[model samples]
Structures are given as structure tokens and as C-alpha cells.
Target: MAGVAAIGAADLVAGFGLAGALVLPAEDPESVLAAWRSLPPDTAVIVLSDAAAEVLRAEPAVRAPDAPLTVVLP
Candidate 1:
């Protein structure tokens, strides 16, 4: 888990060059969905957990083709 956290942090830093804001969603699915839906179209959502990522991927509200969503699982 520590290694995953370290990689996630590094990825966050590397993603800074992108054109949108970086979002780290909560562990819960509902919270993740809420945060994802609230972000702008260009925003980058970094989902760390497999569970949350699965939920977000299944959620239609956050599945816009134009939305920049990234799911990182470990």
C-alpha cells in the first residue's frame, strides 16, 4: 500500500502539466461520484482504489466522453 501511495503521489506531480485541475476522490463510491460530477469537463480525476474506480466507471453521471478521468488501481 505504501508503494501504491508513493506511485500515486508521483503520478499526481507528473500530471501537473495537464490542462485541468487534479482531483483525488474519496474512498467511497458516492463521494467519488459526487466529486467527479462536480468537476469541469477538462478536470482530471485520479481514483486510487479499485472499488471507487469501479463505481466511477459504472456511473453514468461521470462518464462523459469529454471528461478527463483517470483511474489508477493498485
Candidate 2:
């Protein structure tokens, strides 16, 4: 997990093919959104936060059919 966060580090192993960034206090939706936008066009945005997923669902960024958005609800 090179760029993975520390909190939810173990949750994304299967999705990322390795450990993923852990969700920390400093890494809120805004920060995660920025990172999501920075990813390549083909990159996927997998949301592990149920609340965050609901919020993102209302955003235009997540409306497209193939917008590379995934919501993993708890």
C-alpha cells in the first residue's frame, strides 16, 4: 500500500489489487475528491464511505454511466 491511507488500509486490497489508502481525519471528502479528480481518465473512484457515497451520488461528477464511480456501502 504505497499511497494507501492507514485507517481503512485493509479494506481496499481486493479493489486496488493491493492495500489502499486509509481514511483518516485529515482525508475528508474534499481531499478524496481532489485525488479522485487527479486520477487518469480511466481510473476508478471507489467510495467506501456510505455517507460519502450518498453525497457523491448527488454530485454531477458521479452521474455519468461510465464516470468511474463506485459506492461501497457499509
Candidate 3:
């Protein structure tokens, strides 16, 4: 449990970089999942844009009980 990471469209997630979060800009559902799969070891929080959240809404891995806290922005 440590820093924050964000994955989503460039415009939506760009601000996260200002806070020193690991920003991974993804274009599609697959890319979002790929980013999720490769999170840094120190990431304790993951922030996803609404579009990304919708893409992963049915993904079991994203909703895994043991995964880090995930926040989806509107």
C-alpha cells in the first residue's frame, strides 16, 4: 500500500501526473487491461476514468477481492 496510479484516456488522466502518480494512458479496453496487469509494485491505489471503468466493469481480475483500491472518476 503506497502511491497512486491512473489508467485511462490521455486528457482524463493527465492531471494525475501532477500528483506524481504513475500515469498509464490507455486507448481501449484491452489497453486498459494491459495497464492494469502491469501496475508498479508500490501502487496502493488505482484511479480509472469512467470510460476505463466501464471497459473493466465485467472483468473479474479488476474486481478481484485482493487487489488494490480502485477509484473511478466521473
What is the alpha-carbon lDDT of model 1 when measured against the actual structure? 0.48
Q: Kindly indicate the candidate among 1 and 2 with the higher TM-score.
A: 2
What does the lDDT read for residue 58 in candidate 1? 74
Give the candidate number with the greatest TM-score: 3
List TM-scores for all candidates, in order. Answer: 0.49, 0.49, 0.89
- Stretches of candidate 3 off by over 4 Å are none
**Across residues 1-74, which tens digit of lDDT does each residue of candidate 1 receive?**
11111012334433533533353435456666665555544444444456656766676655567545465655
Whichever of 2 and 3 has more lDDT, that candidate is 3
State the TM-score for model 1: 0.49
Candidate 2: list runs displaced more than 4 Å.
1-26, 44-47
At residue 4, candidate 3 shows an lDDT of: 95
| lDDT per residue (tens digit) for residues 1-74 in model 3 | 49799999999999999999999999998999899889977778999999888988888987777787999997
State the weakest 10-residue window (summed lDDT) of model 2: 1-10
Candidate 2 residue lDDT tens string, 1-74 = 12332212234323443445334321356754554455555455554455445445567876777776465645
Worst 10 residues of 1 by lDDT: 1-10
| Cα error, candidate 1, residue 54 (Å) | 1.3
